[model samples]
Target: MALVAFSAVIPLMTVVNYSVQDIFGPGQRYFIGVDWFREALRDPEVHGAFLRQLAFSGIVLAIEIPLGVAVALLLPKAGWKSSLAIVILALPLLIPFNVVGTIWQVYARPEIGFLGRVLNDIGIDFNYTGDAVSAWATIVLMDVWHWTPLVALLAFAGLRSIPDAYYQAARIDGAGRLAVFRFIELPKMKSVLTIAVLLRFMDSFMIYTEPFVVTGGGPGSATTFLSIRLVNMAVGQFDLGPAAAFSLMYFLVILLISYVFYTILQRASAS
Candidate 1:
């Protein structure tokens, strides 16, 4: 346990150290204190990106959780077909992230892309490159297409773990499908659902590559989330001090939210 902790603690300590000091050149450095953190907190763009990230995360959770549960409930409970379904469901997750972005980028183009052509033909006027609504829709739908499988897989595992005795008892009590799901399946799946929610929240909050590749954070700055904005500041503008500070703050936000999620779930389960 000490060895495991040492491995984790060493890296985190390095980030915290960098977050406070200014690296000017090679060995030329100065302790600038919390100036970077202060600046990051004051940046209007940072505030915008943070709020945008929160909204995106909320949208993802809202769509993915219920959709995943429904998909899991619809899936067969047993047999070779169920095994095949599991394999098929996992195929999308196995693909690389950048590749997923590129696939969607082309797929949503109004000219040569299948999705685009269909939408245009149907008079929907969809174009991710030019339209903010389309850009947002594409991002959300891409996320759903890429990630809903993860939720479904987790929820399916949760459903399968439930004892047959519980179902039998529900049947004997004259409970219908909805009651069995609400009182039995949902309660049993709470722990796994919590895990899924946290995982999705963290991933969505930190997402950069897909949106960056697909939209380049625009036709304008419509899709620039905190991570993308941080990268732009650090690499694009060469503002290392502020970038380091922003990165540390970013880590803390994720850590705090994850802690809150764990605490709430634990209390709910205990009660």
Candidate 2:
């Protein structure tokens, strides 16, 4: 715990220090004090990026949660095939983030890419580079493809942990499929699902690598998420002070939402 705290604190403290100080050079520094925070908060691009990030995360959860649960429900209870199924499902996740982006970037090229070629052959003019809608669809589809298995695996573990006695009781009560899911499977899966939701939210909210490599935040900033924007500010533009401040604020927002999710899930479970 002490080691973890020290590691986290050290970097955060360094960023905090940079957030206030203007570095003209190695020796030349000026204490600006919250100027970065003000500028970052007032930036319109920041606001647009944040809204885009929030909406994307929400949409992903809406799709992935139900889709994951459905996939989990379909898995066999016990067999060699179950293990095979799990390994196959998990294959997408084994790919590195940057590699996934590169794969998709090449795959989505309208002229040379296999996917784009098929779509064009089928009479659909699929051009992610020129179309904002196509770009958004590509990013969202890539994220869903990459991450839904994670949610499914977690949900499957939750389902496997559920006692057979619950299903026996449900059968005795003549419970319908929906009722069984609602009252038994879902309730049992609540803890794991909460964890899944929090994990997905945090990951999606901070998504940068895949989209960066695929879109380069192009099609006119359609896929420029918060993390991408922060990188552009801090690294691309070399605006450390505002970038640091924006990052801290971004971290706080994530922390607050995670806390709220935890509290609400706990309360729901308690009630």
Q: For model 1, how does the per-residue alpha-carbon lDDT over 1-271 read when each residue is reduced to its tens digit?
A: 8887689887777777777888878798888899889998999989989998999999999999999999999999999989999999988899899999999999999999899889999999898899988998999999999999999999999999999999999999999999999999999999999999999999999999999989988768788899999999989998877888899889989999999999988987898
Q: Stretches of candidate 1 above 4 Å error? A: 1-14
Clashing pairs in model 1, backbone N/Cα/C closer than 3 A: none
Candidate 2: worst-modelled 10 consecutive residues by lDDT = 112-121
- Model 1 TM-score, 2 decimals: 0.94
lDDT of 2 at 1: 82
- Give me the runs in candidate 2 sitting further than 4 Å from their true place: 1-6, 269-271
User: What tens digits encode model 2's per-residue C-alpha lDDT throughout 1-271?
Assistant: 8897788988999899999999999999999999999999999989999999988999999999999999999998789989999999999999999999999998988999888788889998788998988788888888999999999999999999998999999999999999999999998899889989999999999999999999999789988999999999999999999999999999999999999999988887898
Best by TM-score: 2
Clashes of each: 0, 0
Error of 1 at 129 (Å): 1.3
